[model samples]
Target chain A: MNAHHLRRGALFLWTALLLAFIFAPIVSTIIFSFNADRFPSLPWAGFSVRWYEAVFADATILRGLINSLIVAGATAIVASFLGFAAAYVDYRYRFLGKVVYTALIALPPAVPVVILGIAMLTFEGRLGLSGTLTGVAVGHIVLAVPFAMALVRMRLADLDPDIERAAWNLGATPWAAVSGVVIPFCLPAILASIFLTAAVSFDEFMIAWFVSGVNETLPVRVLAMLQGQVSPKINAIGAIVFVVSMSLVVIAQVLIGNRADRSSKRT
Target chain B: MAFWAIPPILWQFAFFVVPLGFLVAMTFWSVRSFRLTPDMTLANWMFILKAGFFRSAYIYTFKLALLTALIASLSAFPAAYTLAFRLQPRTRRFLIFMLVVPFFTSYPVRIYSTQIFFSPEGIINAMIAPLGLGPVSVLDTPTGTVVGYLVLTLPLVLLLQTFALMNTPRDLIEAAHNLGCGRFRTILTVIVPTARVGLVLAATFAFVLSFGDYVAPLYLGGSNPPTLSILIADQVKSGNNWPRASVVAVTMILTLIVVMTAMLALAYGGRKKGRG
Candidate 1:
């Protein structure tokens, strides 16, 4: 019994250490962002938000932030719409090429971002869409739609087909049944997908780097800044980016979590 | 259904499929005066296939990816086991949430921050300074890259493994214990086999992500030995060699197809019906 207790203690310690290792880098970045030190080192400099101020002062960084917001916002709305449509199709009908359709929808993310980036750069260059924010948004939508589909599909799996059918049998039009029943049922997932995909586009670097030439997204901007020099200002940018993405993700999780809890309770 | 499905299908075909197809076709085209021109030639393929640097980079990337996957799987198993079997559901759920939060954060920022722990005069070295260990260089090394890869993959692998382990029926484990199997023995002879698919998938995911990654290897490893993704970027940015970049991208896609197919086969192969 004593040996078993010791073993359990060791395992707990190991898990704790693992979590620490996972979080250390991000935590350090956040901590250092508030430090007034030029270099992140032993002697803690006085607390300051100068780096954050510098991030705001920089015109290029500001442009990158705006561009990222626009791309993420556009990508979120369109990807969610298309993702809902695709997911609803999967839920509502069975077709001859269903497997193939699913595979194709899921294929974009499996392809490496580098390959996808170059491919987008090549194809969009032809359409005169490369080097534009719209092009980056399009690329992000391709990457994010799969996730949106997956999320909405999960929620749909819990939905009884009979519920929608009963609505239709009660003289409701297909469109009305969809808008009144399916849409409301999937509202949480749709909203979650919006925030999640927006976060995805916000943090995505490689595709944006390839497609957004002059209109660099925040992540792409950060990469350029990192390659150029080691600046404490990066910590500020990192912290802000981290906060924005984290907030979006947390809101998404809460949205999904509430539905999950309610569903589990019902079952 | 057709109305809902056809639009996404068309969109994916136009944006995803056509672009990939165009990439393959472009590989056969040549670059003239820094401009991609319409021409059918194998010169790009020939050059890339024959280049010593390409061969070395390919081998290096493959080896690195394999190492990352192996290490990530092995390390994640213990933590996953604890989460699955030891922790209460509420605690486990919270821990899983912690693991997942990293995915939404900026990956580049994470890789960049890893430099703080690995760089000379960085956190680790500074912490060990009083022990006379002084500064040890880890940044700009393969080790740094591995650490970055772990940052990217470990949380994901742990989550996958935990979910897989959680789904293992409790009765089977209890039956093994009743049969006088030791904890380690039960894990080896029963739990491992039961969760084999998920475990393999977790490793495969680690491989896929690391293999195609550019930022971690570049930012953390300093591109001392350029990975394929790095090569593609260099080809594009420096030489405007879209054809050569296309060649590399095609090779990568082909490699991924082969790897994914083989992994899926391995995960499902020879399993009894209904076992998975």
Candidate 2:
């Protein structure tokens, strides 16, 4: 083959191998969840849903799932609202110390989860919010808000500032202009941020592990189970969490992707 | 506009800034009979710093984080280059989406499942046995820890690299080629220089994440040689040593701030031309 063919073939092979490496753990988790084997190994012991059934039957796991859902939902709403407000403020105004404000908003995700977790744990302990689901939700909201703000901010960057001004000039109040014009323009990003933040909160482990004492989220529960024993049931829990998290992320991606397409077409 | 900004700013101050302040303050406080009493003593910091294990863990964590960043940046480049330059737009987009998917998934699950590939009786050994490469032990070792870090970072590094490389000006590459530069030389002199900021930022991100990651080291490395995160968890779990844990956490935060500032300077500073 020519050098051109060789280069193309090498690139394709590299892509395939990289993808295999990326997905191996996730694929193995899903496969073992369905495998009837007590341990994760090769030579499949036939397919069975018994582990999944075990997951559903467990009281603690069920409670953890419910707790995760609640935390994720609450975190999504609160974080998205705050994130939208933050993004809108950035979009509509230029104030002194804007750089500090932007940097502070972007700082949480960059910090190690261990540090954030302990800080939350210590501070919440003083506030009497420690060991409560509300504490866990609060921690998650802090972590997820930056992500939500980033998404909304990107969308806001595409919006013309004059549209809100036009709405105000047409006798609409500032609040009305925001609700009628700005929010509608940012609706897709807001929805995407909601899902993305929900996924983030749902998959988060360290903060939940620190603050959700006796009210463990699914990921925290998974860790407890993992430390306790190498159970096949953990594989089942992993599969479920993977599905839920991926679904939320996928929904968010689809929304953002669709918005990008529309905006690209407009340009 | 300032009115809309107040709530989020207040929320960040109340939760993020205030909690971090508490962490820093707690490092100076002493724990008495499982109760934390506020004091302005540096005992917690001194105790941890004097402990040999803590010092070793810091060195080990720094080395491992650097190793992860290096390996992830190097290995991800080929795939990232392929995606950015070799693929059709639709295929590239699909691959990019696939990379993004893992970031939002359950990281604990991902780290746990990696055990299957690292164990002596695991898939990696099984695959290599046919080639007469005897079953090698990787699980619970530094090698395994690095693998776990890679699993966390490689995809992210690849995505960032791809985005950065995609932004490389096409005309610059063509101009290099027309000047009789070889393909590799073109990449080195043209593409690499142009995408230096994004590339450096991507590797810095890899370093930052690997430095702070808790799951990979704990699960895959078995916490044998504890990282700072593992040490923090141990301190917190053992007899309510929250003060000691805060000391470690604060050390970590300081390390991150220093490293991030240095990396950002490397990425954006030192150049008269505004590239980034």
Candidate 3:
């Protein structure tokens, strides 16, 4: 091959290597969860369903799983709804203090999560809100809301304002216009935000570690257990988390699929 | 319009801004007689700066973030470039989707697994053992932490730069080609210049994420030299030195601001040259 072809081949190789690097750990975590051996290592033992069964059998793991789901579900609903409202306002009405609005939305991602975690702990002490699902959910909403708003904002920008205007001109009430116009238009992105935020809340550990109190989320439990010893059981839990989040992404993708067409119709 | 903004603004102020303000204030106040006091002083900040361990932790954290960003951006560029320019559109979307799947999973879990694999008798060592490259453990090493951060931030940075490259108008690239530029020459001149600011933003983001991450360092960083995040957590959890922890947190945040400002300036400078 000439230099150009050779360069092309190297590029393909690099991409393949990156793909392997990205997928390997998760793939191994899932594949080895079914390992018959107690330890996660080479010399493939016979595949067994025992590990998946073990995850369900353990009470702490099961409870942690439930707690995680609760936090994630609550975060998705609360964050997405509030975020949609915020994003809609930002998109629709550009005001003089919009710079301040932009700065506030950008805060969570800019600050290190550890600071947020510890800050909330002390701050909650003052409010007497420390160590509860409500507190933890609020913390997650703080982290996730910006992202949710960003998503809905993108979708809203794509949607034709004329459609909403047309509805208003035809004698629709405010609620009626939202239900008949904005809801259908923003449905996919709103759903995407819900799943997306759910994924973030589900995987979140650092902030949740502080605010969670006695009830540990799944990631916290895994971290706590791993601090003591390495168990294939932890791997099993990790596998399940990987699978669940992957499914959530697929669901989000399905929701977001027709968005290009939505935008394409705008121009 | 004001009403539309009220709910989120109120929520952020009630939860986010107030807490952050408290954290900032906490940094100036020092403990007295083992009780939380309102005696505002820079003594906590002075103590943190003077301490050898805290200083080293800061250095290690910044170094590791830089290293991870370097690794991530270097690796991400090739993949992102290929995806943007080489692959068929259908294949490109599928690959991008595949790339994104890892990030949706639990990040800490992935780091923990990286730790597991880097252990002495870990799977990686076991595989390499027969090849006489036996027992390669990087667990707790600065290198190991970088590896963990690399995996965590790589996907994010890759997605970012891939979009950056995608957003670079194709006609500009064609124009460069028509001007007698070879493919590599075209990439160096046309593609990179257009994507410079975005690529810089992506790298800086990767750097920030890596530096702020306590999880990877907790597991992958060896017992002695912990990163800033790990050190801050230890101070808060074990030392109960909330004031000192706040100082450290403030320092890290400031350092992050400096790093970001520098990167943004660099990206902007490059953009000026591109425009010229």
Candidate 4:
């Protein structure tokens, strides 16, 4: 083979290995979810949905999943709204402390989630709000806000300010110019941020572990279950989470990619 | 106009900043048999510094973070390079999509899966066992923790590096190639140097994620010396030593800032060198 062919073969092999390494554990768990036995091991006695059925019947897991949804939902809404506003301000005004605001916006995710979780734990305790769903929501907001802000900021940075100014110059109110023009333009990015933040909040564990007092999210429950030997029920939950999360991410990517393509074409 | 910015700022201050300030303040306060006191002392800091266990945890955790960051960045380089240059656009997009799938899943679930993969009778051992390799105890070892960290952060590095590589001007690479540079030479001298900033940023992020990670070590690391995150959690949860935990938290935050700043500086320096 020529050198170019050798390079191509090597690249293909490397990519396959990388994908295998990334997906193997995930695929294994998915397979285990259908195993007849409880533990994750070889000799799949037979494919069974008993674990799925068991997961459905488990009240605690069900409750945890519901709680996770509620928390993630609330987190997404609050984070997107707040983050959108911050991004707007940062985009529109080159104010003093703008850099500070940007830094703070990027700070949470950069910090260890565990530290943030611990900080929230102690912080909530001072406010007499320890171990509440609201407390967990607050933590999720801190985690999700930065992401939302970053996403919206990227979208806003790409926006032509002249369009909004032109709208306002044509007798449109400032709010009308923003809502009727800018927001409509940025809708895909906003939607992407919402789904991305929701996925993030839903999958969050350490923060939930710390802030979730009496309330347990699905991840925390999974952690508890894992302390025992690997249960097939956990695998069932994993399969559902994996499928749902992957679907949402794919949808978000498509939306973002479409937005990018449109914007690039316009430019 | 001011209302939108003010409320969120105030909200973050009231909820996030104030609470964190209280936590930090509490760290300096005395802890008597699990109950906190208002008395101020440097005892927490002193205790953390003096304690051999805490010192070891700090060193070991930093070491693990560094190792994981190095491994993640090196492995991701070729993948990122190929995606940026070699792959067709359609295939690149699909690969990138697949790369981020792990991120969307719940953090605990991923760690749990890692545990399954590493466990004595888990899929990994089961596969190897048939080849007469016997069982390899991947779970609870430093190697297992490293593997878990690698799996978690590799995609991130790949994404960031790919973004950086894609953003590089194509003409620059073509110019180098036209000057009689070999393909690998073009990539090394022209592409990697330009991509160094993003690689550093990605590595820094990987480092921070691995360093601060508590859940992975908690679930997958068995009997091994705990990472600093685990140590901090143990202090808060089991030891109930809030002050000590605070000290650890402070150390971690400071270390993160220092590492991040250093990485950014290195990236900036590299950019200047490339320009020169």
Query: Which candidate achieves the best DockQ against the true structure?
Result: 1
Would candidate 1 be rated incorrect, acceptable, medium or high by CAPRI criteria? Answer: medium
Q: Compared with the true structure, what per-residue lDDT tens digits does model 1 show for residues B254-274?
A: 998899999998899879853
RMSD of each: 1.5, 1.7, 1.9, 2.0
**Docking quality band of candidate 3, CAPRI definitions:** medium
Pairs of colliding residues, candidate 4:
B140-B222
**Cα lDDT for residue B13, model 1?**
88
Q: What's the C-alpha lDDT at position B169 in model 4?
A: 88
* Model 4: CA > 4 A from native: A1-4, A264-267, B129-134
lDDT, candidate 2, equals 0.89
- Report how far residue A79 has shifted in candidate 2, in Å: 0.4
DockQ of each model against the real complex? Answer: 0.79, 0.78, 0.75, 0.63
lDDT per residue (tens digit) for residues B4-111 in model 4 = 577567656776677667768877899777588887899889988999988888898899999999998888888788899888999998888777887886666667
Which clashing pairs does model 1 show?
A: none
Q: Candidate 4, overall lDDT?
A: 0.83
lDDT of 1 at B276: 48
lDDT of 1 at A245: 90
TM-scores of the candidates are 0.97, 0.97, 0.95, 0.95
**Could you give the TM-score of chain B for each candidate, in order?**
0.96, 0.96, 0.94, 0.94
